[model samples]
Target: MLQIDCPWCGPRDETEFSYGGEAHIVRPSDPDATSDEAWADYLFMRTNPRGRHAEQWCHAHGCRRWFNVVRDTVSYRIEAVYRIGGQGPGGSHDPA
Candidate 1:
C-alpha cells in the first residue's frame, strides 16, 4: 500500500486519506463574466503529467485537514507534502 505523509498526523497508510484531485486550480475571478467554455474548462480541465505532479489530499480518517502533495505519477513516489496555503518543495508557494 502507498504510504502518505499527513502534514499534521505524520506518515500513514494511503487508506487514511482521500485524493482531492489536482492542486492549485484557480477559480474564475468573475463567474458572471466567464464564458461557458472557460467555466467548463476550469471545472473539468486538469494536468495529467507523466512525472512529478502536484496534488491535494485530505487526511479524512485523521485530522481531516487538506494539504498538497508532490508525487510521481509513474512510480507513485511522494516527493513532498505541505499544508494548504504553504510553500511546497523548493519554496514554491501554493497559488490556489
Candidate 2:
C-alpha cells in the first residue's frame, strides 16, 4: 500500500486517507450566470495529467483533515505535502 505523509498526522498508510480528486478547482463565481455546460464542466472536469499532479487528500481515519499533495500519477510517488491554504513547492496555494 502507498504510504502518505499527512501534514498534521505525519506518515501513515494510504488506507488511512481518502483520495479527494484533483485540487485547486475554483468554483464558479456566479452559478446563476454559468451555463449548463460550464456548470457541468466545473463539477466534473479534471486534468488527469500523467506526470506530477497536485491533488487533495483527507486523513479520514486519522485527523480527518484535508491537505494537498503533489504526486506522480504514473508512479504514485508523492512529491510534496502541504496543508490547505499553505504554499507548496509551486510557491502558491490555490484553495480548492
Evaluated at residue 68, the lDDT of candidate 2 is 93
RMSD of each: 1.4, 1.4
Question: CA lDDT of each candidate?
Answer: 0.93, 0.92
Clashes of each: 0, 0
Q: Where is the poorest 10-residue window by lDDT in model 1?
A: 87-96
Instruction: Write the residue-wise lDDT of candidate 2 on 1-96 in tens digits.
Output: 899999888899999999999988888999999999999999999998989999999999999999999999999999899988888886858754
lDDT tens digits, residue span 44-96, model 1: 99999999999999999999999999999999999999999999887766665
The reply for model 2, stretches above 4 Å from the true place, is none
lDDT measured at residue 73 in model 2 versus the true structure, 0 to 100: 90
* Clashing residue pairs for model 1: none
